[model samples]
Target: MTSLSPTTRTTLGRKRNRAASDRETLYAVLDEALICHLGVVHDGTPLVLPTGYGRDGDTLYLHGSTGAASLRTAAGELDVCVTVTLVDGIVYCRSLNNHSMNYRSAVIFGRARALTGRDEKMHGLRVLTDHLAPGSWEHSRGVNAKEFAAVSVLALDLSEASVKLRAEGPDDEPEDVAADAAWAGVLPIRTVFGEPEPSADLPSTWSVPEHVRTRVSEAAAQ
Candidate 1:
C-alpha cells in the first residue's frame, strides 16, 4: 500500500494514530460515500453545504445550478474544503466519555476550477452521474443542450487531502471496564437500497432493470 506523503496542512495534531496515510484508503472512502460537505468562504464567513459528488482518478467533480452563488464563487478557482464521512457503527462504552462511533472520513483541500466546453462539461456531468447511480447515465435519457447549460460543474484535484478512520470497539477506563454496569457493544449501520418503487405513470410491464436489481442485491449483501 502506497502511503500519502503528509504535508504541513494535512498533518494531524490530535489522535494522530487514527490518521490514514494511504491514497487507496482515501479513494475507497470517497467511492463509498454518497454525499459530501463542501466548505467555502462566502463574504468572509465560512459556509458548508451538503451535495452529491463524483470522483475520477485524482479529480473530484461537483455540479449544481449554474446560477448558484456558491458555485459561481467556487468556479473562480477559489480555495475550498470538501469532506465525506461514512458511519459504520455506533460504539457503546460503560462510560459516556468513552463512547464513540466507528467511521471513515476524508477531507480534501484544493482550489476548484470551473469546467467549460460542451465535451468537457458533458464528461464531467457523466462522471458525476455514474458515480452516484453506477449505470444510470447509460440507462437514463441524455441531457439536452438547454439542460446542460442550466448547470455548472467544478473540478478539484485530490492531491492535498487526508483520510482518517476509526473502526474498533469501545475503549473504557479500567474501573469502568471492571464495573460492567452498562451494556457495551457495537451496532452496525449501513446503507440499504430497498426494493425499487417504479414511477406511478410507468407501465406495469417495465420491471426493474438487471443492473438496478443487481445493485440492490449488492447493497443488501454488504
Candidate 2:
C-alpha cells in the first residue's frame, strides 16, 4: 500500500488514532463520496458551502457558476480547502458522551487553478460529469459555447490531503461498560440508490437507461 506524506496542514493533531496514513484510503473516501464542502476565505470572511466535486487522478474539480462570488474569490491567490465525508453508521453507547459515529472523511488543502483554456475546461467538465453522472457525457449532448461560458471549474492538486476513518463501535468508559448502562451497539447505515423515478413530464412508458441502471448497481455494490 502506498503511504501518504503528511504535511503540516494535512496532519491530524486530534483523534490521532482515527487518522488514515495511506493514499489508497484517501482515494477510496473521495471515490465513494458524492458531495464535498468547499471552504474558502473571501473578503476576509470564511465561507464554507456544499458543492459537487469530481476527481481526476490527483486533481480534484469543484463545480460552481461563473457568477458565484465564492468561486470568483477562490480562483484568486488565496488557498482553498475541500472536505468529503461518508457516514457508515451511528454508534450508540452507554453514555451520552460516548455516543459517536462511524465515518470516512477526507480533507484536501491546496491552491486551486481555474481552468480557462477550451481543451482543459472541456476535460475538466468531462471528468466532473463522468464522476457525478456516470456515462452521461457519452450518452448526452456535449456542452455548447453558451453553456460552457456560464459554468466555472476549479482544479486543486491533491498534493496535500488527509483521510480519516472511524469504523468500529462506540467507546464507553470501563465503569459504564461494566454497569451495562444501556444498549450499546452500532446501527449500520447503508446508502443504496432506490428505483429510478422519472419526472412527471416524462411518459410512464419510458424505461430506465443502461447508464442509470449501471450507476444504481454500482452504488448499491459500494
Tell me each candidate's TM-score: 0.92, 0.90
Inter-residue clash pairs, candidate 1: none
Model 1, C-alpha of 41: deviation from truth (Å): 0.5
Which 10 residues in a row give candidate 1 its minimum summed lDDT? 66-75
Clashes of each: 0, 0
lDDT of 2 by residue, 116-221 (tens): 8889888899988988888799888889999999777888888888888899988999999999859999999987888888889998888988999877887688
Q: Can you tell me which runs of candidate 2 are displaced by over 4 Å?
A: 66-78, 219-222
lDDT on C-alpha atoms for all candidate structures: 0.84, 0.83
